[model samples]
Target chain A: MSSANSDTPTRILESTLALLEAPGGKLPTMSDIAKAAGVSRQAVYLHYPSRTDVLIAATRYQDQMLDMDTALAPSRTAANGRERLDAFVTAWCNHVPKIHGVARAIMALTSTDAEAKAAWDIRMTDLREGCAAAVAALARDGTLPDSMDQAKATDLLWALLSIRNWENLTQTCGWEQSRYAMTIRAMAVATLTQDTGPLTDALACPEPPA
Target chain B: MSSANSDTPTRILESTLALLEAPGGKLPTMSDIAKAAGVSRQAVYLHYPSRTDVLIAATRYQDQMLDMDTALAPSRTAANGRERLDAFVTAWCNHVPKIHGVARAIMALTSTDAEAKAAWDIRMTDLREGCAAAVAALARDGTLPDSMDQAKATDLLWALLSIRNWENLTQTCGWEQSRYAMTIRAMAVATLTQDTGPLTDALACPEPPA
Candidate 1:
């Protein structure tokens, strides 16, 4: 705590992520986080009030990235349509390790809170549009076959951006972040175009299961 | 308290799910769930003694279907690879909507929770094996290109099964279950066979304001 206390809010966020995962133990109390941040719980209270506040703040911290409509903006209009779609998928998958449990919390929020709904709605709408454009760009260039439907193509992109499935890969199958990213880009490129290399044999195992 | 009382545990589960999303909603007191479930606290405890117990039971209720190796059996050797993969995706999407938030919770359980991890691990291993066989069969029937990577292919399948993304469709986008199910099948068949049709128009719609 003493080594790094430059930003109190950042410290609290770091501590919160630690507590959220609790690799070492249970979550720290506000007093505990405040002490670590070299501030009073009252100071912590200035930023957040209760444990739920901390959780939701931590949640918002996790969600802030998803809300970014400008991520990888340069690639949105890339010359190659497949590359643009690949760029979007790759960028989204890179956010996985950061937002792991946050997806579940957001899922819970969807049926429970209005603010949560608004936040997620903004992000989803942006993604739907971003995905549609990226894939549509590819179709125009004839990189992807011209016969494809763009709306459903965006759905395909959305499916590839799934946090739940990425969490399943890391948590259940123990795939590292790099492999997950690779899988995402490969699938995006393949699904949007004629790359069956990713669609057909990407999930198989030549070695016997353990 | 009186709307539905067909099963006490089911009622408690519904109440627990509601409470889990509410602010400051602890594991939920038996009395709290009992009141909501329209049953006695003792009745709630008879089914689950602790929050951990409740979570496990809730998890099991959803995982029971994923635990099955039944629907995937036909896929291991189907003559029509497209039909085979279609069945695989159909079984998965049908099973997903019913379990809903339950899968979201199951995924939150860590590697340390032996019961939860064991169940998740078994399901994933089974899914991997199932997908492998299906991919091999699809290859045999010439439905997929020869160079398709099987392991990567399964990753594509799991990506489509993403719970949070699926929930986003119904909960946020106001999509009906049937339409989403159709999306699942279309995504699978189209990606596997590289069929475009209208799906290539993924970028037809203009971007909504972020």
Candidate 2:
């Protein structure tokens, strides 16, 4: 995209996202957004005539940044499939904060607005598939033992990626995001490779090679 | 407490929770809830003078019900310490959906409501400490390897208990709460044990165990 055109969408999306993050964006008018962005009222309408249109574009922009697939692809080079999955999770830890208010907005607004949920659903479905695929890749490569079921592995991956757990660890527990990323990466490695034993105790134990 | 005193508190709290939950709760007036519960408006004020107070109390009530320590305690039988932790996680999965909205509300409030966040923070802080204690207890009993540190173990546990993750798995991925609970329980037990290679594989690989 041309620089001016690129800047135009970024500016518009940034302004709209600020409004959405504030209390009750539902009542904000287009003029409010234009004023917020220092753009002409007419110019605001030139790109997105309605608040819905503005939000739609803004959502797309947010997803482009926070999408899990992009986050995981770079980390896929780790030796085993398990390591790649850990990298995918590390990518998520690194990526989530950039999309402020988006996850919360998705959960709250999706109930009354299917459009909102669809946006979130699209992103999350892609993320889960990416995680599952990363895991399957490991298995196919003979990096993981053959006895494990892919379905179970995928479900386990999703459970580890809990939204409550993620925010709680960062905001409440005050871990640096890197440490947070390390913890999940370790947990994922543990769950996929650990043989039968006391599961919770095993997770809490100091990191040891399998 | 006397029926005339605390009983009214229960009614008001329940009504406030009910009003806050539905399409109607977004902007409910005290009059709306009084009518819903057939209680006098004074009853609400007598217990909670404002919506904020009611919200605080109602949320606390929800927390006690899903407090991970309590729900998971029953499941952690006289098994090895790690096995107990596994059962605890399984029970916790069963407990989350009952308190889902309360969780989402904490993460993404529409307003900069300091009181709500402070109240919520205290609750999460308590959960963090409880998790640390549980891990400590295992280590003390020699069920977990002695190398486990309470602080890091607690952080790891918080990551595992993510609220966003819970919502994504149950709401987005379509797993029954029980299945979600079991997988987590299994992962929890395996996460910190001696037999970690398989668990690590599980985290990384899409395929099932050997």
Candidate 3:
């Protein structure tokens, strides 16, 4: 592809992010994105074959804007299963408020728009993969409760850290962000794993003997 | 008052419920309810001082249609705090699927409609009261975890049983309703109470050793 052809996709993704981040923004349609990018709708279409692809790309763009990898690194590189769970919960809980506006718009759109659903599905699938890895780490350490199914434990962890659950606790129930993170980390540990002797050492940011 | 005057409020409430229950139903405006009730707009205004009042009344109408009192009797009559928690979880979990259609409609409306939010607020306040009572019972019985403040414990319990959380576990995570109820009961007890002793006896429908 020509340099200009490559620039078109980059420009389209940038425009998509700009639209989503605009104050009080609604989910921008393909035409809206094309107009924002100062390109023809056909140009936007050429770069992103479908609206879902563009939205998904824009979500990734937002992640890049926020440097998601750096944010996620502590969890990704944690030394053990419990540490991984804590870091992962903390990273995700903190991430929610930063990305919440775009997240909410995408969620609202998903009920009616298939493209939005597809975009959300892709994002959640990625989160669930992280959750599964955390569970696997616990299983490897023999800290995963023998009674729990790996899949079920993953689902519990994912559901516990879900954006909706976080939103409800922080927004409606009036929990401080730190408190939400700490409590969720504690709760996730309690819900997903078993006692592997002296596991407290691995539970970073323990809440003062509570 | 004439019989017609007395019957007007009932008819208006019935119309409101019908509008919400209809497939793809939007939150009916006062005018829509008035039309559905075959009454004048003035009549609707006379019966309900505001749209919020009408919607709130309609929600209560749904509760009555479901005979919420009988549904709640088990929780109210539970012999102890832990049992109260279990019964409450069971009642609310089962109630969600039964009322999900209208519950979802009202939730969708809450974003754009103040009246829908007011209605939701009233319903949640009622739920919060139940949570508080359960906590109070635990505190009274000397089982409330000393580490947990009563208010915070109530918030945790209420958040655990939130409709969104239930929806995620059942719909997205694909848990059976019974499993969701059982797990939530276990998690709630483990999260809220102090004792590791003799508590399983109070956990109604305990999943056998799993």
Record all residue pairs in model 3 with backbone atoms less than 3 Å apart, i.e. clashing.
none
Please identify model 3 stretches exceeding 4 Å from their true place.
A1-58, A196-210, B1-58, B197-210
Q: After superposition, how far is residue A84 of candidate 3 from its true place, in Å?
A: 1.6
List fnat, each candidate.
0.20, 0.36, 0.23
Show how many residue pairs clash in every candidate, following the order shown: 28, 54, 0
Q: What DockQ results for candidate 3?
A: 0.25
Cα distance off (Å), candidate 1, residue B163: 2.8
B11 Cα displacement, candidate 3 (Å): 9.5
Q: Could you report the DockQ of all the candidates, in the order they appear?
A: 0.23, 0.26, 0.25
Candidate 2 predicts chain B with a TM-score of 0.71
lDDT by residue (tens digit), candidate 1, B14-49: 676665545443445557767877778788779887
lDDT tens digits by residue: candidate 3, B5-92 = 5377888887777777677655577789899888898998897788767877777777887987798899888899988877887788
Selected candidate, larger DockQ, 1 vs 2: 2
Candidate 1 at residue B189, lDDT? 64
Per-residue lDDT of candidate 1, residues A1-210 (tens digit): 232744777777666665555444333667776775677889888877665566567776656636544667756656687677767777777766666555444544544455665665665676678778887788788766443466656765776676667766766566677777775676566556755343545422233221
Per-residue lDDT tens digits for candidate 3, residues A7-111, read: 778878877777776775666888998998889999888878887778777777778879877888998888999889878888988998888767876776675
Top-lDDT structure, candidate number: 3
lDDT value, candidate 2, whole model? 0.62
In angstroms, the error of model 2 at B175 is 2.2
